[model samples]
Target: MGLAYIFLTSSWWQSAFNFLSLWLLDVPVNAYVTLFIVNGFIAPAILCWLYSFAMLLYEKIKNKILIPSIILFGAYEVLLIILLVFQPSLVGTVGENYIVSRSILTLIFTIVAILIALITGCILSYDALRSTVPEIKWKGRFLLIAFIFLTIGAILDSFSWTAIFLVIFIKIILIISVMSYYLGFFLPAKLADVLIKDIQ
Candidate 1:
């Protein structure tokens, strides 16, 4: 997920890659073209991550919904890739710094991505929260918080914020999201015990 957003948000890297592409192919690269390449990569990576995360949480649960949901979303991911390749215009208009238009395809992509993240977060946090172990419950708390930060940061990032402080604030939220994700999985036992004393 971090990798996906880095490519989406990094104009510096995009500019550098554009320069390199122009130098090599004598073709100018606009933001839309750059996004085309990055989105191709990001789409699958996000889907794979979602699947792995879901599997990690839902492995033992005999839920019939998980497999079908994965398949459905996987098809959506493929459709996104096809649209990106064949009908780039439907996605958005080319712009100097970013896509000039937010078409239905873009909206659908964002919605799907957010939906997957939300579902994963809910499942993981709910499963952990219901665990008998105090440590697991605390981990669920961090995971829930992490996903909230992540969702907010991602949504804010989708907008083109001209204000520097908003950009910085979004990055800070994402950083905290990552930290909370780490703690969710590998929180020190002592720290967990300290924080979760009431539960114990």
Candidate 2:
């Protein structure tokens, strides 16, 4: 995700003012447009699919609705990879671009993939929340909040410059939330028990 943001900032230039600067700098408009489509759009779309897979794995291991989530996630990844490889070229005139005819299809696929990822994330979050274990409750809450922030960030990208900044802020929050959840849930219990026994 950091890689995705770096690509967006350095190559795509998210701000409208930065976009205008391209004209003064003598950079081809199509180049920035292409970078936006490929890195800003497609790469993050692919990451969402990967995230769904990770959630599917967690569900299966934790004995949730394993098979269906895995199958759906796998299908999503396949579709995302296919769309990424066959992306319509933004460098040329719209109708003349390669894969132009398939643009609608790609868009539909991406939307479906995003929806699947969200659904899977919700299921995993719910499972975590419902666990009798205290550690898992905290982990689940973090996951739920992370996904909520991520969704908000994605929506913010469609709004103004301030919204874009909010998106970046939410991304940071999501990352930290997930990291802290894992560290707290996976490490503390066993390590604390070991340390207690050694002290005795």
Candidate 3:
């Protein structure tokens, strides 16, 4: 949806402002835009998706802890819709580069939604890490770290493609970490023991 927004809604620029364009003085506008859309918009959207799945899993495993987390994340999703509707950005004439989102309500909702998502996401990850099942418990820790880096990368990467590449490099390492878990799950138990050393 967000990517469609970028391609479908093309507009001329007043000095080409994107989430990262202001800070990144040297990079091309296309790189800046690509990073902003990929990291800033798509990343949070993916988090929303993963969190929803996490809620379902946690509900089965940890119902008591799941309730508040669901509520917060649900509210976060709702506000995210509001943000999408408004489409935050700097757009206007040369002298007056005002915000594209006109309603202050939308702005406030976006900020609040971000805060709710962040806090509850970290909490949920922590609770998941506390599971007594050794496998789940350790995976939970990795997930918590992944979410933290994902969130940071999502926000910071928007400002520059340099940051985006850095984040991607880090996440690639994380992907390898995660693949070992899958290997541990699917491979022959004896082989798994040898092939997949414990990461956490």
lDDT of 2 at 5: 27
lDDT of 2 at 185: 40
Name the better of 2 and 3 by lDDT: 2
Q: Show model 3 residue runs off by greater than 4 Å.
A: 1-116, 161-200
* Consecutive 10-residue window with the lowest summed lDDT within model 2: 91-100
Q: What is the descending lDDT order?
A: 1, 2, 3
Please list the Cα RMSD from the true structure of every candidate, rounded to 1 decimal place: 4.9, 9.1, 9.8
Error of 2 at 105 (Å): 5.5
Better model by TM-score: candidate 2 vs candidate 3: 2
Give lDDT for model 3. Answer: 0.42
What TM-score does prediction 2 earn? Answer: 0.44
The TM-score, computed over Cα atoms with residue i paired to residue i, of candidate 1 is 0.69
Error of model 3, residue 64, in angstroms: 16
Tens digits of lDDT, candidate 2, 110-183: 44544554565567678877887656666667666655544554433322233445646755655564454344
Per-residue lDDT of candidate 3, residues 1-200 (tens digit): 22322221122121245435656765434532332332234224434444454555555655555456567556655654554445533211111222122234433433444344456556655675677765555555555554454445334322323344664574464455344333322335564344336543
- Per-residue lDDT tens digits for candidate 1, residues 50-160, read 556656755565246456656766776577667767887666555654433446666567656766676677787898999998899888998888888877876775555
Residue pairs in clash, model 2: none
lDDT of 1: 0.65
What order do you get sorting by TM-score, best first?
1, 2, 3
Backbone clashes per model, in order?
0, 0, 1
